[model samples]
Target chain A: MAPLGDNTNIAEEVMVAEAEKRPVSTIVIIIAMQTEALPLVAKFQLTEDLDSVFPKGVPWVRYHGLYKDLHINIIWPGKDGVLGVDSVGTISASLVTYASIQALQPDLIINAGTAGGFKAKGASIGDVFLACNVAFHDRRIPIPVFDQYGICAKQTFPTPNLLKEVQLKVGKLSTGDSLDMSPHDEAAIIANDATVKDMEGAAVAYVADLLSVPAIFIKAVTDIVDGDKPTAEEFLQNLVAVTAALDQSVTQIVDFISGKSISEL
Target chain B: MAPLGDNTNIAEEVMVAEAEKRPVSTIVIIIAMQTEALPLVAKFQLTEDLDSVFPKGVPWVRYHGLYKDLHINIIWPGKDGVLGVDSVGTISASLVTYASIQALQPDLIINAGTAGGFKAKGASIGDVFLACNVAFHDRRIPIPVFDQYGICAKQTFPTPNLLKEVQLKVGKLSTGDSLDMSPHDEAAIIANDATVKDMEGAAVAYVADLLSVPAIFIKAVTDIVDGDKPTAEEFLQNLVAVTAALDQSVTQIVDFISGKSISEL
Candidate 1:
């Protein structure tokens, strides 16, 4: 039997090649935070759809425009109107991704976000990673058989060519709604062999997989999980600089994705 | 301001009254487990829609039939094809609920399942509860203002008349995807004043709220979260008995809901 990674790569390659015969044209970039999204929105010259493409009363926002040969749409679950806080978590991310796919019918999805990295896994603040896989660390359904389902570990579209072309770090990304790691979460992350942790990536991956849309993840580290600093303090202090790094990485990705097919990536 | 209970009741009454002038004819029950759903399906004499009502290639199942004057439908995220495990988590719950609402167009949603209950909150195994509100305990955003958004607390439709008619415990429900509680999760649950904890209720509520569909949660305690017993062992030991209890309570509630308006409940 082939290794899990080998099986995953073979499956992804076949799925992507068979699913698309033309070069990827329309792309949806699902970003959870407004601060993390602003730089990319500006860089891509995306215009906000003030006409409200989503359902009425939802705080979801979509910015779209043509970038080179690709039609790029950046969708963010906008701030809660009453609380004035950006909606960031698995629920909001999955909903927005589902809605965006249904509404835009994009060829591919790119989940870009800021995350906490593990220094032990060779990560430092402001380093950008292209996730090879994504899984949930907090969804710990401990029942037999169901425990694996809780992880929901999914391989992102295998990008062997992209890995060769881009000089970005690649790692398994673990996602939970929490910003801070608990003992249980830490164990689960270690089990998943995750180097990066974020709130939205796996949820987006779930939606993308469900809808049979090829997806990739680009995560920028805002804080080091194993470092001796409070998560909230470190995250807030480094958010600006990390987001810029995320912007640069995502820009390069989008540039690479402009006229390439999924197989090429 | 009036007390939260009073305000919630008043607001719920107004929303229920305004949303539907006639009695509710269609109802969707979102249950996560087949063990919990089979009894209700039998009680309602629902026929499995083998023709596949949902999108193709998905493991979601829907059973529907008429119970008295009410069109009853039960939706569950079916077992994973590969692992043969029930897909139980916030992600699956949210997606299935969203899709069910879109497809069924039900007048109301009832999230019925087993949950771990706090003994400190006056709960015992097999004791059924009507969730007054639902929130997430594991989604710790930690950022100011956004922390509240992470909790995602939303009030369930107030069933004052039903509470008066039926003898059942009422409490707030805290949700996370984990079957076992982490210390951080326990803290968040306490902060939410939650007496019941489940994997799917808050997620169902989120989707229902987004779709403007009234949702009610009926939870039966399968394990004591704060008790001396291990959660998995206790949950497995109590599941069969508690599911029976859940079936009975849900039958009574459905009977009461039959031929009645949302405001009447």
Candidate 2:
């Protein structure tokens, strides 16, 4: 296979050239998935969280990392709507992520994770997309439009422009904290819903924004809310394709930014 | 002053008592203080939306009456914290006052308002003490292994157990969403570095804990946090007496809940 790479060496050149113009900080890429990180790790021929798992501070598996100038990290934000619902996982993990990044005081942050897709038709498994905006998936204060938006104190930093760059092939995305596994039939009946659903995106944006770090949130679309209830294992198995796509995208994104000028990037 | 009467006579009692006795639904109260709806409005005054100001709607303000039980109405999950130092006045006028007994869900909630009290020998502001538990004001997290605990998800709720309710000399209190301009010290300190600091009590127990319909939160501390630099306006202000009292014991809490049984008084 020729691979998702563009032999034109076009993306890397485009980024490096741009870097010469505008200032670009060392970019960090994070991936969030519900399954094991081995396959993805093997593909890149990189050692995973081996250090953390081997000596074993925590017997249970978890994801956190400090890689190359890329600074990639990974985590499993829990699955099944009710079991691990709420923004806390995202907030807590993001806090750790932010603290780590803040130490370096990087200029930008990029988060990649898996999410549920709710399309009516070709909403197949393992598709990749980018989120434009994110909402608290679990928070639903359904006040009528006639009612005021009321007061909510929140901090959401700007989504990286790189997200906008992928809008063409990937398409737009929406996020909420709740994992809407209501099955396609039931979800279709709901009055309001989003195209993609995930938990961490907004929380990451919030903390990153608070610290003045621009952030990019991307996710692989894994499960479609179909009538037949799929197990978490099934969902993880389906994530393989999307995972490969994510790896390719992150490298390209980094190289692309590398090419840009400091001022213009 | 008159008694609060039995909760049963209060209507929310007749409607909620049965359900609350069981445990299907839970009520939670958060005092953001942005919309100053009368405390009683949640109980008796039924409106589509506060009539004029919110004739249209109030986002999170919920109104649910039991089937065929019209008098049984309660509103909330109101704003979490007061708007800001700016909107404190206009919004508080219509939404808050010390006159009404607003009926909010959650049988037990704490009014966590911001305050400017001194930890300094004579002028430190910013302390969180339980009204009743206020017997002793000084605290450090996990001290006495009981006080100053946080009630986030994955943790057990704080159960004060009506800690020996006493007599009522200064009972029958009301909540105000307005910020008290006292103890200029807080203006010099708070807000600059907290997720939130408002015109109510420690919002911790009120918002995070899962409770029945009898929750109530009251915060009587100062409401603004500038920096250690108090300006001319802050220096001449008389804040000691009131704040000192707010920092006093909660002995009256039990007496207040005395005559009022789970049913009617």
Candidate 3:
């Protein structure tokens, strides 16, 4: 009876210590549009908009909510089509991602979105890719010192061992700020061994890497880079499906992150 | 006397026809800060906001004015650090530049700003540089197909003959979307033979190239890359002088663009 009482005290102490330990509390999901982010927002049960938490009246639009013991923020860098061809893309994505990181100090950032895939590389519509690496395909720097414009230094390596738990393609993702990539550009991207092309992944990864934070790009193949089936029609047609797949990928990631300890991640 | 009358009539017709031709009516100058743009804005006497001209309540900020029969538009991407490190440098500049191009359909875009210089490459404080070509030094795209991030295709070759009219060093200007460059990065830049570095030049050039519009970058050396003094201190100390030089360069460019026909340029 006396030994049993002592054992109960030790068990209570351990339980209290575990309760005091904090898990990863903040998570930032960077998506270009409401549609892309909607599924994750819904899946995470994120309902609150912490707009009041930010300073009153700034053009920088931001949203926040709490999910499964984590704070979630969703921001649109700038509006779509307020600019032109490059409107859907912006350096503001990097800026916004950086700002969100600084403010929240997120443990991990998931840049979830859709991308144009290289059909020849076996990227099919509705297929989700977790970026093992990300590069800039359209950045043609003319200097002789470097061979390509892709910033391979910032290649976002996803936790492959952990990623195997999720069923998805893991490969190189190439990002460019513009969408009108020519066939020649497609050849360059393919030559680089990139399977996916996105507008904001590398930019997001670049900032996160600078800050020494881990970021993963979870993208769904919406259109093929050099596929012959009229890019505009294909992209528009597959937009919903890709976004749906993106939501599923983000959910899997969230579940993985939430279930594991930071040390494991 | 009758022959003389006929000659005079022909001269009048030719003058009217030339005026009707309207050489280069629109010029877009994309600058990051209001201070950098102030001199040109003042020099050109740009007094209109043109905010009303855009669809009301859009995030895209713009300034417009009619100067010597040329429409001048200047934009400030985002205020310095509402976002961290990559705040001021944005791909939004490209998007906005493209939008401005589409709206104004400018014949020429002059990306005027201050840059960190390469002293060994013969760059000094207050020295102006006209970008013969622009590349991205930070883009390490580990790929085999493309040669450089430098947009050699849109090489802004100074009318060497016309550039002699204005005294400024002309060379390749390298650009990246970040301010941080280590000694190793600096060495890479030097090896690439890039004499100057800035954030938005390559992006602006990329967009302009896509639209097939001619673009040029004229930058003033504000600080030496990897120089002895702290970059913030050096850049701040030289801000006034660099802006002054930038203003002078813009004046020279304005004079050239204004005086010569587009065909000559």
Candidate 4:
């Protein structure tokens, strides 16, 4: 948490035991997976939290920065690489990398990533895979698909209470083993399911479940099911849709956090 | 979904699905993220589900195969660098990410990354930061802490249920903003946290709440809090620690997925 600098400091949020302040009721943490943390930070109005830094929190740190005028410290878990691809799947490896995120007493958490698309009838590149539910496409038992569920892991995922509570258009998500580039096949896979194929959805879902935070996972289909790679690589504009959606979601989440959505706290 | 060649197809657990013997519940897909997927083909296992060709998820693709398997997949909503250092503060993006993951139906999840330790505590160049709970670290209001608990996004993270049910051991975790990698500060941050630092845990926690999956998130203290230049390049062991932890986490996660221990899985 310290390596991220004062910008990621949570010391400001800490209530001095002597202060005798109210116990924070609704604390939320936001994680932006994959790409760098610049774009998201660009949209926020930040105010440093000066009191929290010291022997307890990060050194050379300020209080904490604000995002969208909301309160919560942020971290960029960093671009991922293989921890042990030989033993664990990419998704599983990702889940264990941050084994202590649960330490923070957060009522809610979220994971966001860029995903490839399966050529679904209505699905196209840059579409947000607003996962209604996520599953391992690669996992399969020795059983046939027509009979029973495949060999899926037992890990849990983040809850989507806010996902449903917030009114927005969403597409289901499907997990896949490989990056889908073929329009025809991706289309077929999307045709089979009502979502997009991403690398981290299942992993994030698994972690959130363990933490018991009401999670709301979402992804922006970066490219078409077979959108030419390198052809569209430069754009990476796929995140734009996700950002747009996030911009919209903030209003609702903030409303809920402030107790304005359900009942004024 | 189609890139997986049909050559390798193995099942771990078996059950009678549709009256036919099949894997109980598991699916494994193999792909290359940043480092290219071909060389690793030899590392492929029999318990894999190939797409079509032998060693074929997407036959003849020269992908970098980036991620080496970090334990947690903290998907950031930042696409094309729209965010900044503390961009992960917003729960909206994180919540959206959580919703995408929930669709997968995992049982547990977590986030891990590199963080800067700002203090001169035990934060070592290659230690880790383990957090018991995440504090917004930034929400400072004029009202008393108790009165404004609603305004703050500080909270606690839920434990991984499977780990509890199965009894898995957990290490340390911490939170902060500074990437304390100075030989002294690095040791301090590492001594204090676990051995890592990075942003995104809080968001991951927030999303995990929605999914109901327990999780753990920690970052390898990559650099010192007071130093600049990303210490990632300066320290070798610090880099190693993250990868090692990531590897350790991969095995654990796989065991969780396989319903077996690291050795058994």
Candidate 5:
């Protein structure tokens, strides 16, 4: 150790190189449940639920780790305000995402999880889709002034260059707080040609858009929305598979971001 | 302070009385913009933007005041995370409301603002509507397993007894982040018999539902969604008048809540 820095030229070069490498300090990945987060948590070798460090939990619970010199945070805002029971619904998803953003102030936010694929749109179970645009199909405001209300008024899409860089399959996604599909609703959703449906994507995207924070939503198909089996059952049955796929997608995304220099982003 | 509580007996009596009286220690009122909050802020004499005191800024900017011994907070989460230009959308409203809840942990949350009334549903401009049950006409999750998704599954209504005590003209509100409406959408909304439409009510209600926090949504009719004029134009033209009405409604609501004892609630 005493002679380690004796090579002045090499030490200086090493320090300069280290300083030149742009690092991603914080990247927040939000998911609805611990199960959805487990894969990423394990893959990233996170040993702590950051929420535990704070006796009074913050709005979002973050699990921190380091991957390839980049800081990674897997966040889960349980169904309750901070922590309690696991809750479902768009509102919960949106609130937790908001809390995560406020608390972490991360450089990038990613919502990665499972969704019901629209088979007609060539979506199949296990396929991962990157959101080109996210719309809330359930926002039905019936008025004469604005048609955008019926659809999520603020449809969020990744910037073109990011898409070119990520080079993932792009698909429009429709999100709502529903586990089942009705004929009329299905028609409306299909009419928009969305490739997938999930409870949280649109809500997450909506928050990111409002904050002007760049977000990428990656969802793996869990089941078909209108398949013969009930969506709840199908979703439950395929959670492990879907989560695995989602974990992979997130890992790739993290690698890509970690590989990039600050200037490139 | 003249040794206000010098006497142990009197202090005990006063403390008991205070404990018995159901005081709303924190009442969080969320509105989309400053204009919507103007009436309440003026009425309550909140001269300081609580954010100013923190310097670093809280998740949601809080305006402080007192109404009949009840703490009042008027909050707005502007665009761009915590601060920036005010944004009008479902996402912003939901996130801000969530942040407000996290920051204030208020005993009660009220979403006060203007909304579009459905003339066919017996609504007219300038009228105040208290939310009995809030549903999202736009959350049309047309799936088989979970019909609630299409209808915001948790359609929160004040306990029947509370509604009776409040004695306000109660109506069901449909919320979405849109300023305009189309004919088809209008018909669908009308079919649902929603009396009013606004951007933030449903989102707030959705959050309140998750937290099991009691929330009241008070809105003044700013325009008729299917009225002769465009909703945008009508909303802008009538904002002052509508806000005035909304202000009055919030005042009344506060008075009602302040007047109630914990037992009454």
Candidate 6:
């Protein structure tokens, strides 16, 4: 009885020690566009790594610093050296997210970006959203069993505390590589019950799931998908303002996440 | 003058030594389906790593062995543990390809799979093609410069010698996560001048280019995209026969690559 009591006491002490450590310490934010990254970089005061933490020749950029008690790293797939365009698609997002996870091994990943909102789903321009679920809108495999695999729907890490703390809209987010939705994409998106759409959310979610990393998506509305205006025109028109909204929401989120456990969130 | 001559001789000896090492010794073959991977695995006499070379909980399978003088690894994203369905889309393809490349640094990547061939481009059932160019048909980002980036068109490594040695067809290949082509995808495919379409070729190409590894694509026609028959029905009917053709073609190609360098090909 004495030895058993000592072992029990030792186990309790180990449990107490584990509980004392902060569950969420390091955070990595994956942003696809430089325009979307700049505001957050300024707000977080993240310094660019001039030596480049990523592989050579690729235009992937990393900015790092500490926010409060949390270590923060924001990574973006930089502009194409030849085409001079921001690398904004699922392919680049997946590659960068995979590389970031492999390199940083952060406790949490936050995919913050701009997306097109659906007015039918009660979304408006410049509204920030915490995505509850994410899936691809364009991968349409028509085979029997493979049809569902094409969608690859995934749920983001639950943050009920964060949701209650912040007054942000919550919705299902659909992802596709296309900026403009085709008829097929519309049908798929409707089936997905998605309120917001972006190019990289589901891809990032897929990579995160593959690596067993918990991820949260915060998307700001840049355009109304079902609206009358052209997608490209509306996106460009609202990018700057929407990015500001996203930056503010992300800042609040990171502040809340600091010194808190994943279970607490 | 004597010292200069000796230095020249040493330089020539170093060049000869470099040339003597087999340049194309390690090869990775990425197949998306089990039915497509079985034949190649059997032909190469590869043993399945039941212990699993991939990360735990992922269904990615690796079959590896020595084929003649080359080290060949055939990787397939296996069936979903819960859903019991083959993981078959760009998301799974990209993640598995990235993981495979990181784990096994290979000299070449050969994406071998079944594809929907276009009758308008003179593709017939069971026709094997070595893709000359690879691009995406469904990633339709409509922004000004991003319109081109969405397609992400890339050229495959040239194999003029192999082309001369083999009698397989050669054409442009377009990739999308969708098995069924949308109208927008069709338009993009036409613009890509694609003769064949699959779900993973361009994704594999993207990762390969990011890692600076040379890649080649081998596709066998399983269905005619523009034909009168239904895609699913036709694809099901031809899958077995097409796999045979793909196996034969891949075997011949591997045999050809056994003793040659990338420069020689």
Off by over 4 Å in 4: A1-36, A45-70, A80-100, A141-167, A181-192, A226-257, A260-265, B1-265
DockQ of each: 0.50, 0.03, 0.04, 0.02, 0.20, 0.37
Error of 5 at A25 (Å): 3.9
TM-score of chain B of each: 0.93, 0.32, 0.82, 0.47, 0.81, 0.91
* Cα lDDT of model 6 by residue, B141-206, tens digit: 777778777788878888898999987999999999888888898999999999999999998987
TM-score of every candidate relative to the true structure: 0.92, 0.42, 0.52, 0.36, 0.70, 0.91
Residue B238 deviation, candidate 4, in Å? 41
- The residue-level lDDT of candidate 3 at B228 comes to 89
Better of 3 and 5 by lDDT: 5
Model 3 misplacement above 4 A: A1-199, A202-265, B1-22, B50-60, B78-87, B146-154
Candidate 4 C-alpha lDDT tens digits along B57-138: 1011211111223122223222111112122222222432343343333334445445555434455554544445543221
B14 Cα displacement, candidate 6 (Å) = 13
Local distance difference test, candidate 4: 0.37
Q: Which ten residues in a row have the lowest lDDT in candidate 2 chain A?
A: A53-62
The local lDDT score (0 to 100) that residue B193 gets in candidate 3 is 80
True contacts kept of 3: 0.03
Candidate 6 local lDDT, A52-142, one digit each (tens): 7676446788999988898899999988654778888888888888888888877788999999999999999999999999999898877
Highest-DockQ candidate: 1
For model 3 the TM-score comes to 0.52
Q: Is the docking of candidate 5 incorrect, acceptable, medium or high quality?
A: incorrect
lDDT of 6 at A38: 91
* Rank by lDDT (best first): 1, 6, 5, 3, 4, 2
Alpha-carbon lDDT, every model: 0.87, 0.36, 0.64, 0.37, 0.67, 0.85
Where does model 2 exceed 4 Å of error? A1-23, A30-90, A93-102, A142-168, A181-193, A226-234, A259-265, B1-162, B165-265
DockQ ranking from best to worst? 1, 6, 5, 3, 2, 4
Candidate order by TM-score, highest to lowest?
A: 1, 6, 5, 3, 2, 4
Lowest lDDT 10-residue stretch of candidate 5 chain B: B1-10
Per-candidate total of colliding backbone pairs:
0, 76, 14, 246, 25, 0
- Model 6, position B85, has a per-residue lDDT of 80
The best candidate in terms of TM-score: 1
Taking the tens digit of each residue's C-alpha lDDT, what string does model 5 give over A142-254?
44322353465344544454456654567888876655565545765776678888878877776665444557788888888756877777887898978887888788778
